[model samples]
Target: MDSHPLKTLLHHHLASDASAVQHVPYTLASLTPAALLPSPHSSKWSARITSLLHAKTSDARWAGLCLAQKSALLSQPVMIESAQSWIAVALPLLAVRSLFLPRLNLMYLRTKRKESPPVLRAAIRLLRVIFTTATEMPEFQRQVATPNVAKFTVALISLVETCLDEELKILLLSTLTRIIPIYPTLHRPHQPALTALCFVYLNGNACKPPNAKLTTAASQLYAVLHLTGGKVGAANLWRKAVDDALDFGWTALSSIRTTFLADGRLPQVQSASEPITSVPLNLDRLRCCIVILGDLFSAPVHRLVQVPLGALVKFALALLTCSKEEKVETHLDPTTRMMESLATPRIWALSCDLITALANRQVFLGEAGPVHLTTLQSFGSHLTPSAPRIATCIAFQLEQELTPSERLPFLDALEALFSRCYTTHATLVVNRLAKTVLPCASSVLSQQEETPVVELESNGRSKKGKRVRDFEGDEVFKIRQVVCPTTVDGQIVLRAFAVLQLLLRNGGLSPALQSIVCRVCLSALLALAQMTPASLSPDVRLHALLSATIQKTCVEFASASVDGLSKSLGLIVSTCLAAGTLQHEIEYLLHPRLPPLLRTMPGIEALSLFRTEESEEESHLIKSFGLASVAPSAPPVVRAGSEPVTLLPKRQPTAPAAQPLAPAVEPPAALIFRPTPPAPKPPLKAPSPALKVGPAPAEAPTLPVPMDVEGDETNEDMPSIDLDSDSDSE
Candidate 1:
């Protein structure tokens, strides 16, 4: 067989030299496909690679790994052909399982030396490339990777456990992440060790100086393992993983709490016999716990797991309290500095995220199921005391220099906290929440207000005129303006209003605080009214919601007997009027619960006139305002030529004079009268001709009829007739 071109190069330059081995990968990468896969020499090249990988020296094995990585990167066909052989040869170099064994004898110790960093790195890189390349081809994976996946996974787990180099560990984690999904069942056996390793790195207990790249890789790998590594359903695995993370975090937190107490960071009740020893705070562990919790909370879980919200709330409150504690240290280590930098903001942000997640999941107040109710009870018990601290933390986070996107979570968290906690601790939550949120919301909204337009006059001389004069003789023009908030700012304002509404609706504010809230709401309403129609569609809804909120604020104030209720209501009415909104739009302001002073206001009266439907409440409102006369009434009847007819009262009847009693007569046996049969009617006479001749005579003068007087004796003397009498013959 012809000699291969790389044989001399590998044996001479790359066999014992590290620098030459570094260039081997580049040299191999630059070679053409024809050169890499020479038909007659392909078998010789494979044999050489296998021999080199199996060589005693680490340098030769390093060179072999480089060549394999390059071969795998070329194409699927080459990877399929060389993957099995490369894996077999490289697995021993990558595995650190033998390092844990005792030194049996001198010969065994000498033969079983751990691989050098370069060789192991090269091996990991080679495997990463192989998996990355093979992931694209089903044939390579099913044919080559299927048979060796179990051992391969075991080797990776060993390296992860025993590998000391952070870079190599990151590489190994990335490699595991890529292949865990493909052979999830194979990884099931090693899932526990893999999980522990991932947590080690994620919790930052592994290395002193925190490596962001390492932590990120471990986190991603951890997620992948739980999502795909288990034989159980993904949902079950996800829930269990979340629960495990929570438990792990709680343990770390307990340790942190103990340290805090020992160090006097937190107040503790100590006994006389107990010795006082200062323990250092494990900021690294705390940071790791926080990062893990943040990731778990931020990710979307498919199942509804009953999270221990009480514990989580306690954890968050502890962190917030710890963050505020003053730590006076003249000197700080790198790890401390790193933890301080990352953990502070992350602490606040994670608190916000946790609250937001709990709210979104509806763990506390979603349904009436047994699980939800239990969670609610536990959460309430924990939150009752810490509600103020939680609100303060949220407010403090909002005051930070956060982007609109970052501010959104804290805002949502604030709103959720207010909504859920306002029931038990309404006064405390409302006062704190309103003080912070209202100002922030107002400032953002005020920034978005349209800037005043500047008007300038041009003094250039007109073409037809000689003297310099004002252009168009002092005709000033103003530009029309619209108040359109950006997408993010608009959302912030909307949420702010929603929170304010919640606070106001809870009816727990002092009169002074209520006034401040009213002013804020009115200012927002004015701003919305000034918005142009061409503004975003969301603004329209915002305008409506703000109007209702203002009305609600007014009603709340009125019911609470707060001062300036009328002023608030009047301001709203005037704002509606100035905004050109129809009077009926704010008819809610005419609530019966409102003070009677609203009735005397012209705006209220005008709005009342526009009410198309008369509810009982409005009727009561009108009556309380003494506005019954102002209400619409029936029209009066009119006459054509004479004056309107006057209504006359009926006259009383006069009593008849007493007359002598009639004498009683003796009864006859047949006193009943019988009517005789009527005679036949006579034939009609022919007198019509004489009556017609006489009809030509002049008619007598018509006499005017006398009008009936109120007490007319002439009509009273007439006898009354009884129609029910049995005198038919007469």
Candidate 2:
């Protein structure tokens, strides 16, 4: 088989060959170490490779860079230790995952002195890439299995434990999550030691700050460990601790966390999705608690059902409500308020997360009928009375926080309430949400007014350095700061838009009301898009969605005036075009991909073939409605939109004449090609043959009896009745 292209590239870079591109194909494919396997001289190779680590010469540094790429792309069991030692020295250099200096650019690539960060990023990225390959690609898993890769796993586990930076910890945890599951016996996670640190990844930091990859990694890890190892090894110990803690019902982690949720049992997961097998290890404590609880539910035939569902929900509610670190509102100053405003909902969100996870677990477990729904019902039963309070909390949090990460759980809780008991609680939640967001909806998109600078007292002493001001106390400044849309802004907009969209779709609001709110949504979105540059993903997406929402609802609420709808549509479309992305409607119009019609018919006339009978009368109906006031088929002098002068048949007070029309003589039989007429159904009143067969041609009138040019002959012809009347009067 031909050598992989990335391998060729790495080899050429190691050889410091500029002409290597000519020798080897320079195509980019997925980078993997499988091709770089089988180092026969593995023992002696590290000594020779270590010289490249100093990277003194340009070619040597190039070789080091190549080696870093190789370490990421090409480590098998034979070279794992050597690669690790090399990685240790070069770990700090792994700063850039996507840097590519072409082999052709030897001078620039070689002469670069700063190499550590790049090497470090390359190393970390390699961990990610390899972990991904091992997890996804079975070939790598089967072919690359080694007896001693556990040593490397242990080192990585240690690194994850000690790593301070969330990014690095994430990288390490992600690597371990993949490694643990495939070779469960290699390490004690599924075998060696499924460390608490690993489980912690699924909590606050992983789930909320929303390091999605990390969270996913951690979740996968836990699930994999649970499924493969089946609560054996260190997994059993962790499970036991959770089982013991929950054996006696505890309301919320708060009641138990201080005493029972110790570091040994408790993980520090800031947020989760990451599992030991799937999620990155988070350092957050609360995240660990929830993740462990989740693991308990995940295990086969556990004690979760024994616990009251109300207890779980109430615990979640209390945790969600009280988790806000800030107590007593700080209305002190703009800076303080703003800082408080943007902070996330914290562990309270995590508590809600646990409830959601529990609910999901019940759903997936499905050992019995309707267990998940029952759990949700229990949750709603408790939430119904506190609906207003929960609704208020949700609304306030949405307003206060900039990041939607922490708000997600609260939103989940609200969704739970809605789904479980929409009648009593859904309206409360939705109304609060709409009321909170609607006021700011327009203002967030509004143009900023310049704030006048306040007069500062002259201190006379020259300031030594540039002073950065956090807040200047002007309404405009505060407004600008508040409205400066970011990912968080996009999230809120999406959420609010989602609520309105749902309401619009589910017939949540009346038609007239729906139209009005839809208009508001469109207007607000337009203002947002206008203020927002299309370069931002959220902004572009919001604009795209705004266009879509309008389209979906416009047809639904047909009572809306066409002129207003047109203006609204024009606003969104023009804004998108202005922003440089084509509007969706315009895209469809310009390239209508309708199914092909039968080609037997010619050109546009084929459309007439499928016309419905009602469609034929559409023009008449249009004319009747006064819409087609000035007919296009009318005289050229007539203007469009003019009131049509319709000639209606005169109405008769009496019923229609029932006299039968004189039957017409049949045409001569010689015209044999003519179509035969069919007998028709009886009519209510038979029309005259003149009406049925159309008026017969009138006979040529006899020329008026010759009238004298200027005499009584004319008078005699004028009418004997008038002359006789005169005679009789005389």
Candidate 3:
């Protein structure tokens, strides 16, 4: 920490003399080329530099400038030090830099005006020289090791964090990127710094027209460390970074609005601090988000789960929304919203990846808890609005036919998206799936079926009978047409089937909802099933595998049902065959596909789908199809004090009232009212009304009364008696 005599002397003399400052460069220039870094004077020069490098000095505050200048001057352009001379100075300089370089920019930035700080600029150059002289050259490369790398990475990371000059940050990061790979094993000591550094660069901006050197540095450094021994640490760091970025994305994008400049460009409006940068910082942020996710996704399943995927899903949407092109009063199309960042095909691709990643990350796939609910709402907002475009991008990319490794992740993502998203989001996904399958479906639907027919005629060959008509038959064969889907199309459709199945199971659908979804899924399912390969091809094999996977999921991972899915598959064939693309299915096929469950009750039709009786439109779609009929309107409401109501059927006037056969036994039942029956003189000829299912109500009992088990009212009690002495005559 103490100042060296030479350093103190140089500082003091340079202020007063001014001649000493001029004398040094001249003195160095006047020296013999070998003496400057001359072979003859190499040993003595190396010795002096070694002493100067080791000397305690007041250089701590100005280390970046002093060391950078010294490093530049020592590694002269006119005469290179023999590889031998590098031995003494190279190790010490590297050692000193690691110790001193971490905060090179902070002090420099404070004193700097608009221009880049001299110290940091010199320092970046110094690092480049050290890296080239040491790691890049084969002769001195042995000096690169973990301890040195740790120091270098830490220093560079600190500079990157504090350096205001984007140029310097880029320089520092790029240098570290090269050095870190030389000794990837040593970065643990500098993990935190590396993580922060990666975050900055992965989301950093460009210098001119736009580039991603920092992003590349970030990517390289991460790859060297993480892909080797630091998988666990890397995954943790990535997860944390993703969560943080996702939070920032949510906050940043939720508030990010768009407006049109006078020139017709959609300018992004964010908080005052988030100044717009030409490098597309939003794109960088999205790139960072996707990189972390893309890497994590490639990690083991357990490691992948470490990510808070729900946030990633929201973050992806947030990225798109934030980057969306805002068309104002201009001739440009309003729908063309892919910005510089999003317009790059990768952004759209990443968006789908994150969506798919989110889908794959089902801790509780169908859980209806608070977290799931939030995820559902967020996913709906992000996906429903842009699913068509996202799908288009994905389809286009797939059309490029990337390598299996490259393409499978996308397919996995699509499968995950279809399996995981639900409700309206699920509807959007189903629509995408339908679009994916429609081409194949249309091709298959055009094929025709042939049936074999046979005719039997009486053959006149009299082998054994009188009128032996032998069977003369024209044999025909029946060709049951199969859907004939392509291998890729079949696999994609099969996956689509899984998605539909997941929607029903994951949504915890009610019978009505399940029925509605079944119908919707069934329409697409039928279209897809039409291409269902009868023979076992790759697509057919995948179908069988998918069926088993789904069955297994139902058995273990999820509470879904293979049988239910099979049933859905069957219904898809039947209903779709019956009502080709059920009216409501088309609702989901359009841009911004909305789930039928969102605005309407589960019903037979969507377009002609009628609201309940609450509406005054007086519509009846169910009745129109003759599937059901309308009932007569209800009678008007009766007042509380209105006349007594009766529910009894009207009596026939042609028949006289019947007398009870047990009239003699019933006369003693009510002695107090016996006088009413005394004057009856005519004999009753009519029979009683036929006994109904329940006991007939007594004629004398009031209609509103509650039935008592002990009422003891007999059939003979209230009978119309025969008054012509018919009982006595009998």
Candidate 4:
């Protein structure tokens, strides 16, 4: 040029009067640093000028002004000192990546060698603001502002991507991530710069971009999917990325997978439509995606966006069928192929999680609803042997999310599937059956008595806690206990014992004539709390059920003869009594109805007999059957006129008396049973004449008048008949 424009501008500005500089505003038009390759003529003068610019200044304004003075101000300490002013002027102009800016950045990098990466990272961050504004500029303003800033950003990102230093690349990509949205146009454009950037970003070699960046990139790809008529521009991106990752040619896929699983927000990318990089939809990617989505759904309803649920399900479905080759065929071998055909842990976990999330919202469909039924029915038709288990696991998860009212229905649907899986199949281990139904029992129990308590605040106001006593939410003051039967191979196992004891002792189950249930219950109780753990997890519901189950079992068959009901009951009673938790249930069994049930139980009753010594017999029977007794020391037989005992009492044998008494046999068989009320005719005749005395008019005590058993000694020997049972129905 006539003279380098920056040099000419600087000379003109400097030659002007210092005071006049205040009013005269000068713009640097086409100002740029002189070439590092110097001309022979002005070399010494240029060197002097550079030295002066580098000199220290006492005045800040002077340094600021000098920074604004010319673009030739590189290499000056003043330029570094006047960062704020330099940024103001240079940011707009230097937004573009070119020879000049690269050299300037190199100089800045060299000068700030001692700064930490973070600090240097901060310095480059200013470029984001500049580029952001540059993209928004009007066409004419962009010309005046900065040229090719968008392309420059792409180039800058490319340079970072090519770098070997991982940390630097991460920093650079992070910056690019923020700046890229400045040109939303490139997000879909297949122009050279746009295409190059897509490859560089997708290649992800520089540093594993953060989850946020990957999310953004994913969103952009989705945008492209929507905007570009399903452009094949990105067709190659997904294949290349996934294939390269498989070969370890690129590690970004692994990093992205980690982020996809860990980040609950990735499902938000659903709005990003028509994603080109189906890398995220590949089997491994989908596995992580499902987990993350599930986690989000598992969170409180407020934490999840409602629409994402359907979209995610759709996305997962697409991925499952998208490949040209069957997914099973991709595995290394037959076994691997079989496992793939079945759900992997990650896949199973994903399915469970997704189903759980869907169920959490009462939005059961797909694997959580009717489709799940088909999945169950078809059990391994097209799937591997393990598929049945996977289906069960998924159903179990969905079942777990149903409200108490919904659980039975959910289970019913699942049970059909379970039945189809095989004659014997369970998502839960046998021991873990408690986990399944206890929650249902707990839900019922919670509803039975949710007495609200007021919680006072500092302001003297109060609030009621959630009605359900979920430990995850709030502490519950009361816990209701219930018992359920455990089944094994169509037979009641240890759980049946608990159930029988509960029915007999608590009177809780319906279908009152369930005689088979009783046998089932007794058999399980016979397991004697063996399968019951010594300690239980704090799954409040499960623990309560187990505790109640154990308590019922103990009280029911404690007197088993094999263990001898007394020994068994004693072990249970002592265990419970010593523990102090079973005292209440023990008291409940003392209800009038309980003892006979215990005494009549053949196995249980015989065991009670074993606990008693002849000397201790009557009292021992009273204690074991919990029968009320006249006295602790009362003999089993009462003496009246004292006849030696003919046989044991109908209930249980009693203790013998110390003395033998003479046989007081009735005078005659007829006399032994008194039936003679002379004749009712005497009552009328007596009332007519002799019976005019006092209450004699009561008519000879009324024929068929119930024998005054309380007053009659002979009647005393008669067992107390249950009068209520004798009452004829009207």
Which numbered prediction scores highest in lDDT against the true structure?
Answer: 1
RMSD for each of the candidates: 27.2, 22.5, 27.4, 25.9
lDDT of 2 by residue, 1-730 (tens): 9855444554553354343223222322333555445554344334545666664544454444454455455564534445445544443343221233241121221223444433434445544444444445465544443422443554455445544566666666666655654555545433325545544554444234455556555654554454234333434443444554343223224322221223334323232222331122222444555655665555343122333345555555555554233333323334322332322245566666665565455322235632332222243433445555556666766666444556545556554544443344355455446544443333343444443332212221114433223366544635334342566555544455544544443323333333334445544545545454453233556655654544443323322233433444555456556545545555543443442231111122211211131253433432332333221232212111322221212222232333324333233342122232422433223233222122233542111122111231122211112222466567
Q: How far in Å is the alpha carbon of 130 misplaced in model 4?
A: 3.1
Candidate 1, residues 1-730, lDDT tens digits: the string is 8555566445554454464567775667555565666455566656767777887778877887777777667654666777888877776665554444232111221235578888888887877667656566677777766766666666777667777788878888888887886677767767777888787776544224677788778877776665453444654675566667667655554443332332454433332221111112344555555556545543333334445556777767655544423454444334433444444554555556566544443333335432332222323333445567777767666655767766666777777766665344447656666666665456423323232222212222223434332367343463333333556655676677777766665546544454445545555566555654345333556556555555554444433332434545666566656645536545544544456444222222222223234456555543443334322332222121222222222121222222322222112221112111222443212233212112111432211122232222233332333444679977
TM-score of each: 0.43, 0.44, 0.32, 0.28
Candidate 4 residue-wise lDDT, 1-730, digit = tens: 2665435544655443342233234433333345322444244334333343333431222322332344224323223333333344333322333444463343231231132333334334534443444334365225432443444454454445444555655656555545443443443443444334444434322223234344334324322222222233333433333233233311322222322322233222222212223233344444434333432222221111113333334333322221112422222334323433332333433343443333342222343332221112232122224333444343354434333232333333233323333322332332133224332322211212233432333222223422222266445544533333222211222232332332333222222112223323333333324333322222334444554565565555443234444345555565566446666655545443454434433344332232233235434423442223322322222222222212122222344332212232212223322333333232211122211112212323211111221133233232223333747875
Candidate 3, residues 393-507: lDDT per residue as tens digits?
Answer: 5555555534433344455555565444434433444434433433322332234333222221223222243422225552344334444334654454445445445444443
Reference-based TM-score, model 4: 0.28
Q: After superposition, how far is residue 682 of candidate 1 from its true place, in Å?
A: 99
Question: Which candidate, 1 or 2, has the higher lDDT?
Answer: 1
Which scores higher on lDDT, 3 or 4?
3
Candidate 2 Cα misplacement greater than 4 A, ranges: 1-13, 16-144, 159-168, 185-192, 197-224, 228-284, 287-312, 321-367, 370-433, 442-494, 507-516, 525-730
Local distance difference test, candidate 2:
0.42
Worst 10 residues of 2 by lDDT: 598-607
**Candidate 2 to truth, TM:** 0.44
